[model samples]
Target: MTEQRFSRRRLIAVSGAALAVPAVARAQDVPAAAPLHRRNTMSFVPQNWQDHFDGLGIAAIVADTTSRALHFWSGDGETYKVYPTSVPRTDELTKRGYTEIVRKRVGPDWTPTPNMLKEDPTLEYMPPGPGNPLGTHAMYLSWPAYLIHGTHDTRKIGRQSSSGCIGLYNHMVEELFAMAPVGTQVRII
Candidate 1:
């Protein structure tokens, strides 16, 4: 056999090209518009406060049930925030329309609503603690038993898991709690 010399650089180049050929071919084989299965995950579409509120009076919050998101705008209209949230479990439990933040509490206690007790008698009054459903902070709406609060269970966020309240992650609620003052206009759609 004739003596053959192969440089390391040439060998590396050849090997790299060989490896890349399959990847390039595979990429081309994929269809440009392949259908993808839908997922149950948090995906926020940017919302304009003007569309939902007349003005950002003391701040404005819109809890969108279909998108499972909460949008906030500061009173001066300088700051805007979007947070993934857990909506009411069902339409029957959902209270849509306008309301305002009537009260705010840090470490809020949980008293099961009369309707809630009727549904599940086991739900007792839970004091503010680890077990409390209304996580670290709560902003009570004008509507009774309806609140936008944090949840201890992280899994509840971005799902239909609340009895009637809008649920946010504990840290997110704490942030929102600080931003939205009492009398902040709220719209649940």
Candidate 2:
């Protein structure tokens, strides 16, 4: 285990329910006494540790889709990378039949249907076969069948092809594997 400065507060709030939008935390420079005003339909709430972990920490996520680019953000927005693959949402995964996802290191989950995924520190890949999709590295989110991992099918990279998991190139996933910790927040845009 590594030392992490994560907030127990956010963990507590999430324990109550999985789907609620966890509060977005604000910067320390902002005053707690002063309330932030919203100018649009989307009201701005204070971002929590998780929010800070996103744009300003070791976390990463698939921010969006492009015709060809599979995007990811890591290292306080300093590391930007893209791969070729389609990411599946909980709804889509549920449609396919999986409803529970468990991030091994993270308890419970946030998706409507849980999809269990886990990192094999032992370098375990599913199906126990050659060229398995799990690749050399992985970030196994809760969806039992899904994961953020490398791809042997390089041609499928940058396309919406996976059932509900995020795909990356072999080298890219390996790099990401080295950077993200077990607790790093992964926001699939």
Candidate 3:
């Protein structure tokens, strides 16, 4: 057998490639492992407004807890957007069905729900600021204490981390808050 030699650079490249092969193969094992966007949106499902709404009255929003995605459509059907969201932490905390946006607030204060307070008496009222959980904007739902809002904790996005609200990235919520009017129809599923 003839002796073969490898440069130091060549050895490292070969070793690195060899180490990466298994990781790449493991990633491909799940054929459905794909990202819908730049974020951690692995389970996003493309939704049609027609399936959930009777009509796009002014604007419509559908928050899909199962997919951890929020879908929005404008009244004229000209604007459509999808956003990954943080859903309620448990099915028990989830309130499904239809509701309308009753109000909008910028720099919203966060008051823990009665149940939330009961569970954690340490929780105190929070005024809107950098430390507030409601991020920068909020759109209240017809249902009491329910909102489509933004979270300061970005990790909460793309995960089931909310008490009952649907959460978006602060930037996304700011955008949605601008596009969605107070009367926007909302559905949670």
Which candidate number has the best TM-score?
A: 3
Score residue 178 of candidate 3 by CA lDDT: 95
Error in Å for residue 17 of model 2: 68
lDDT of each: 0.93, 0.50, 0.93
Worst 10 residues of 1 by lDDT: 34-43
Per-residue lDDT value at 103 in model 3: 96
The TM-score, computed over Cα atoms with residue i paired to residue i, of candidate 3 is 0.84
lDDT of 3 by residue, 54-153 (tens): 8999999999998999999999999999998999999999999999999999999988888998899999999999899999999999999999999899
Residue 10's lDDT within candidate 1 is 86
As for TM-score, the candidate ahead, 2 or 3, is 3
In terms of lDDT, the poorest run of 10 residues in model 3 is 33-42
Residue pairs of candidate 1 with colliding backbone atoms: none
